[model samples]
Target chain A: MSERALVIERLNKIFTTPNERVVALREIDLQVKQGEFITVIGPSGCGKSTLLKIVAGLDVEYDGKVELNGQQIKGPSLEKGFIFQEPRLFPWLTVEKNIAGDQSLKDPKVRGKVHELIRLVKLEGFEKAYPKELSGGMAQRVSIARALLRKPDILLLDEPFGALDAFTRSHMQEVLLNIWETNKTTMIFVTHDLDEAVFLGQRVVIMNPRPGHIKSVLPIELSFPRKRSSLAFQEMRRTVLNEFEKVEEESYTVGAGI
Target chain B: MTVEISEKLSEPQKKKINWLNVTYPWIVPIVIVIAWQLVGSLGFVEEHILPTPSKILTTFGTLLGNGELFYHLTVSGQRVLLGFALGVGVGVLLGVMTGFSRLAQEVIDPSLQMLRTVPLLALIPLFILWFGVGEFGKVFMISIGAFFPVYVNFFLGIRLVDQKLIEVSEILQFSFWGKLTKVIIPSALPNILLGIRLALGTSWLVLVVGEMMGTSAGIGYMIQDARAYAQTDIVFVGLVMFALLGKCSDSLVYAIERKSLKWRDTFKG
Candidate 1:
């Protein structure tokens, strides 16, 4: 694995809706060393999704450059796997077909990899079930296997488990951590859940609401498989919580003066 | 929460349905048949104008014994099968081209939209003028009737494919053709199947009218022939045959739709 897998520098994004020009992101700069798990947490309209889109090369209209493995992101490529909030699995396809859908993966060698991925996601005995028949968590597991099929260098996820119930959400977090440990692939996840952000990120980047940009980047020194209730984990969570309150108070004061 | 609520609500639905409700659809037909039989036995109307049920049954028996009924059925079946095949083939091909290409849609859609507004039944004289008093005119009429529904449904189905699914395919770097085969077509199948069902019904509708115009050796022609001779019993037999055939064909298409969409978990309500 390469050392510097992803770099975003001086990134800016403005969405031009019919009625208004919305500044979605402003002067955002972030760096992820290879195999790092970074979580982005912000309020609504904080441009977290836009940031992931830029990194995935889904939106190139943004101002700054995003480089992956020394190559400037131009457009969507198979190298960076993306998972949306919804599972986004083709409803018409069965579980196995959805994961092994790429024509190149039809080869017997790559097909074996698909089976391995199915097992990795714990979707055994569901090889032939359609999307409608599976539960939401089960469907998302298939989506994860689909992204991992190409062995992408980086995985960008946008609120992937936000729609799931609490039990499913916690289980999915554990499953994701296990997959990350096994693959050691660089992952950047965007979520609004504070506990989720702290639980998943090796480094948590908190962004402010208006003119969305990173307000702070806090690094967690705790070792792998960190307990959520541990002193170090709780300390990190409180630190992230304090930054949110500080930003909220500053915004409130500025609004009152104006 | 939604799943839990739906599961609770589903419990009563899973219980055995009422026996009366199970047999509900057949009730009206049975009542109507019994009423007709009573009217015939009571001599409520003249035998010629309102043929008795027994008279109609006897007519059916004779027609079957002499093989006349089979001949007319074979002729009508052949026309419908040929016209339906030709119409569906052309419609699907054009539908795919228009759906896949903006240029094709620009050149084709407006013209098709105009044609669709013109009642196809009113084109009988025009067809007769072109291919007069022959099998060609009758078959052409049936084909025209079948074409519009198929074309309209296929175009709409292809265009209305979910954007989210397309985006996923895009992220996977699917080729244009790959997207069409795997994502677009499969998603569009429900609408396409609806179009086929509508097209088949139209085929039957136009078949009767087509055979009634300048034709011989069909159920429609036999009805017309019986009316001219004032053979009301034979006319009744012809009408009943048409009803049975139409029901059979529609049920066949319905079975196909059920088989193809077995994966879907539609709400019973």
Candidate 2:
């Protein structure tokens, strides 16, 4: 259970813009335990998404070492699944086909697995629907389902519910929590919502904006089906929110009068 | 419950709801034909110059019965098919090369741009002189006419393949052939269809001119030959046959395009 799922060492990302060198990430180190749910909370432009993309191997032009399952991550593999903010479903495919997208899972048994996950995500009966026909929340569910379809060991979600409504977001969070419980897939979710971070994470990591680094990592110490109104849950949310605010202020001072 | 409501509805009611599908295309053509016929019958023009629906039908049948019409029609049809195939084949090959390599793109793009600028029909005299007034000259003319559109489309289609989609393929480590077959071609199909449509129309135009001015066979030749003998009705029949052939070929491409894009067009509403 204590086996490391991922290790990020001395990560730095500098983009050579037309006029100046922009630092997106700086000297960041992160480690994840097997089957742990880690939520990264930060203000927008805090490079939380950039960190996730780097780990996903979607962006490799960074000074970093991201290792998963005892091997260095160089590019995306079936072991790691990525869910974007938008569904980004291939418009030419139906939900069922999208979930089965470009996978080697040709076994008829795998299809049964897809149908089960479809129900787990509460996307049953809409399997044949196109992405455009689905609501924002529904489409995001399909994205999650598609991510899970590969049976990935590590699932990296970049604010998958950010565009969804409050009710829908809560429902999807619940669905995600349930799936994590059953499958024990290592998840690293990036979001700006502190409550969401507290709601989903076994540990909440707050990142600072501009030259983004982990400001703090707070353990939730809560059980599954976490009560939104519980005192511990509220306290975890408050502590993370304070850390996020302090990081924002600190970044402002450093970036002042530039 | 909403899913139940949507699913439980009868197919007939679904059809009724999408009545536009049933009526629009069918109705528009009928209306246009009726209007054209009524105008012609109501003394809009002399019968010898402009035939009504009934006169046109009689002309169509007589031309078919005489077997003179098909002799010319086949020649134009064969020319279009042969040239169009060659043009599209070369275009796709060149387009793929241009799209994949920066060095190839620089070399090919300049050449393609210059070649596309040349009017294919203007090369008719040159084609006749180079290849002689046989089938090769006309086939070459039609091929050149079809080549440019398909090349441009195939090239642009390769370049515009969504970068994200390519990333997905790369992430999966698809084999070279697998990526080309599964990702590139499907993504490029719509643009490729557009090119095919344009190229076919251009081929028809080129074939007609080639056959009319320089040959003794084809619907164009029939028209020109009729003109020489002052056979106005035969000339009109040839013109009508040209229109029909053009419509039929265009519809064939369009029908296949619809079938291919059925899933994509589902979002049109």
Q: Which candidate is the best by TM-score?
A: 2
Q: Candidate 2's residue-wise lDDT over B1-269, tens digit each?
A: 74883475323235445687668868977887698788888998876666676776787788899887777778788888999999999988998888888899999899879977887777777777798778888888888888899999988988988887777666545578767765788778888898999998889899888887677788888889878876667777887777787888889999988877655744556
lDDT of 1 at A87: 98
Tens-digit lDDT string for candidate 1 (A163-199): 9999999999999999999999899999999999999
Which tens-of-lDDT digit does each residue in B124-221 have in candidate 1? Answer: 88888899979988888788888888888899899999998988898988898789878898889998988888988999889899888868789999
* Model 1 C-alpha lDDT versus the unseen true structure: 0.87
Fnat for candidate 2 (0 to 1)? 0.18
Candidate 2: give the clashing pairs. none
Fnat for model 1 comes to: 0.45
Q: Which stretches of candidate 2 lie over 4 Å from their true place?
A: A104-107, A256-258, B2-48, B51-53, B172-178, B265-269
TM-score of each model, paired residue for residue = 0.89, 0.91
On the 0 to 100 scale, the lDDT of residue A164 in model 1 is 100
Q: RMSD, each candidate, Å? A: 4.2, 2.9
Expressed as tens digits, the lDDT of each residue in A1-258 for candidate 2 is 899999999999988988998788999999999999999988777789999988888888888688999898887888888888877776666777777766434668778877888888887777767665678888888878878877889999999899888999999999898889989999999988888999999999988877677888889898988999988778877877787788879978887335
Q: What's the lDDT for residue B122 in model 1?
A: 87
DockQ scores of the candidates: 0.36, 0.37
